[model samples]
Target: MTSITIRNVPDEVHRALRIRAAMHGRSTEAEIRGILEQAAKPEGRLKLGTLLNSIARDAGGLSDAEARRFDKLRDRAPAEPMRFE
Candidate 1:
């Protein structure tokens, strides 16, 4: 394993990291390691259905009627093409 030294991190950011580490019951160094690990890994792509489901869940789950109305709005015809002289 390699070691690194991060130089000149802002005081507020360092403080926040310490607070987060305390919250998660980890040392600040361990918290930094976890942060670096997550940053190094590529995040998985969220599919449209998955993204929509998450949004619906956060918004208290959309009603069936609301979903239908959204679908109708989404399927509406595009606006008329611009006619430039």
Candidate 2:
């Protein structure tokens, strides 16, 4: 196996990695290796169903007219106004 070195990592990012490793009950090196292995796999793209589901969720099941109405309302709504008394 080959060795690699990652240098000049930010303290906050390192701290985050430590926290994640602890959460997963893994050593920092093991946690990083697992993540890298998953990421390095060729079949790494988001699954089509997952992508479509996310899109459908964001779209809120609106019909064409409903979406158009929502866009119009969003565009015309006041950005800021007085709160209700």
List residue ranges in candidate 2 displaced over 4 A. 42-85
lDDT of 2 by residue, 13-77 (tens): 99999999999999999999989988886476775545664576588875667655655665444
Error of 2 at 26 (Å): 0.7
**In model 2, what is the error at residue 40, expressed in angstroms?**
0.7
lDDT of 1 at 29: 98
Best by TM-score, which number?
Answer: 1
Deviation from native of the Cα of residue 50 in model 2, angstroms: 20
Q: Please report, in order, the local distance difference test score of every candidate based on alpha carbons.
A: 0.83, 0.78
Error of 2 at 25 (Å): 0.4
Residue pairs clashing in model 1 are: none
- Candidate 2 TM-score versus the reference: 0.48
Backbone clash pairs for candidate 2 read: none
What are the models' TM-scores?
A: 0.50, 0.48
